[model samples]
Target: MRADRLVSLVLLLRQHGRLSATALSRELEVSTRTVLRDIEALSAAGVPVYAERGRHGGFALLPGFQSELTGLNHDEALALLVAGSRRGAQAFGLGSALASAMRKVVDALPESHRATAAGAVQRLLIDPETDLLARRTDTEEVPDTVVTEVRRAVFAGHKLRIHYAAADQAPKWRTVDPIGLVTVRGQGYLLATRSGSDRTYRLSRILAAKQLAEPAQRPDRVDLDRAWQERSTRFRTGGDQVTVLARVNPSRRGDLVGTALAVRAEEEADADGWLRMELTFQDSRHAEWALWQLATNAEVVAPQWLRTSLRDRAAALATCYGVSS
Candidate 1:
């Protein structure tokens, strides 16, 4: 690991001369002291590197120094730079490896190509933290050790035992034959099977994971995309789905629609600036959460249980806040 870091240091110096110790450490994700030590190591290894004493000056290699690594063409380097800009590598527990690879890719390109690739990738953003509406997206955090174990089992075709905590349930250990891992919209899922029946587990819900030595019983090859789509279809069609008729404020209509699986019907805005609609949700709990998020902006007209539940919740809140019952 130190050897790789040393080589990366040299490549970095050759690519961008006169980088400050702080800058180098930031690029390498190391401490400033580590950068200083690396500089000493490089100098002792006969690298013609020198430091300049000034506010703007830093370390630089001897003139005409260039690495012997083959350079990437403009388009090739740009493609890698673009892909590295995405958060996909983090899903597979390869974030650091991807960062190192990205540095190598930049070092392998000619100066002209490097500039072009950097500009191209900067212009193309992917998987931003927030959307145009300013609503932040949820980021599911999975522990590194758990991800590593899951990846190991998936690649080695071994059975995995995971302590999974499903919604509204106690945590329990389950052994699964892992098919693969899938990431969508920042959330990760493990596609596996238990007793020959397909099961998809959210990676964030996994409290712990252990790779078993026993081989997994799965197909030699799988179409992961197709498998994910099939599972999604089953989930959408098979559930304790509930339909609700609601009159919602015009501005909150989009927020309500976003949570529903389907909008069966919608009416134009009434004189009171409210719109009537029929929406279906995955379950009653999901419906409650969605309408709850809207507060008084959306009113549930049908599904008497939902209305009563919301009313009771409001009453509790009022009592807690010392408002009249």
Candidate 2:
């Protein structure tokens, strides 16, 4: 609305005095012509706006003028409220601060925005305690000492040394330049660079950590989201991939696909009502493990070795149970 834009223009000038027409255009995301028109409108409305000339000069409001109208719009307020509802902030030790800020923001919003945003907040939930199956979910645990040291390096731009425990390996010390922290699905990760190469470590696998006094060698600015996305792509594509052709019960198809690294192809239900799926997993071990989870609900139809492996495992299990047909 022009009305809202006009109000925003006035507020922007009030907050940051002496802004050029071009600066106002950038701030308001409008063209300079629109800004000039807004300025004329404000002046005709008896606002105390005045223009100054020269290289460093721009528009400024009279010192004594002040406006009372201000508040976030419905979408903006709801976005902040929804973000605050997430549990990810707790890992960064901002739980109490986030709660406090959320209250203040809700209080400051216009009455309509407040009510609508509050209602929207209750309608959406992130990282709930239990999933659809009613099973409890728990986040990966990192020791306080490990979290604090890593957090310090990330915020202070310092190098960090940590005792990291990789899968099936003894803990080893490594020095890395701390970039930022990211949490997804309740698991925390430290995104960093080692010898100018990208590295990501699971926070729970950090046995110990120390913030080094030396400054970190990294770019002055970073887009953490882009960096995390790149790392995720690398992880998804770098593994020893094994594609599996399987037939699974229609109802349990989702369970089987969820364990795969990627689903290359899927077909409609066959005569028996079983769906045909072409799935890719990290490796043979991964493929074998994923299909095993569904038990009789899924069957491997290709990679003859996989069928034999499953048959042998079934035989061993039956023998161990001392069952005979």
The per-candidate count of clashes, in order, stands at: 0, 0
Model 1, 35-95: lDDT tens digits are: 9999999899888899998889999999987665444333234335435435555666666
TM-score for each predicted model, relative to the true structure: 0.79, 0.63
What TM-score quantifies how close candidate 1 is to the native fold? Answer: 0.79
* Overall local distance difference test of candidate 1: 0.85
Q: List the residue pairs that clash in candidate 1.
A: none
Over 79-134, each residue of candidate 2 has an lDDT whose tens digit, in order, gives 35436435566555444334434554555576568668978988988778899999
Off by over 4 Å in 1: 54-57, 69-85, 120-124, 131-135, 168-170, 248-253, 264-276, 293-297, 314-325
Pick by TM-score: which candidate is best? 1
Model 1 lDDT-worst window of ten: 70-79
Best by lDDT: 1
lDDT of each: 0.85, 0.81
> Listing every candidate in turn, what is its Cα RMSD in Å to the true structure after a full C-alpha superposition?
4.4, 15.8
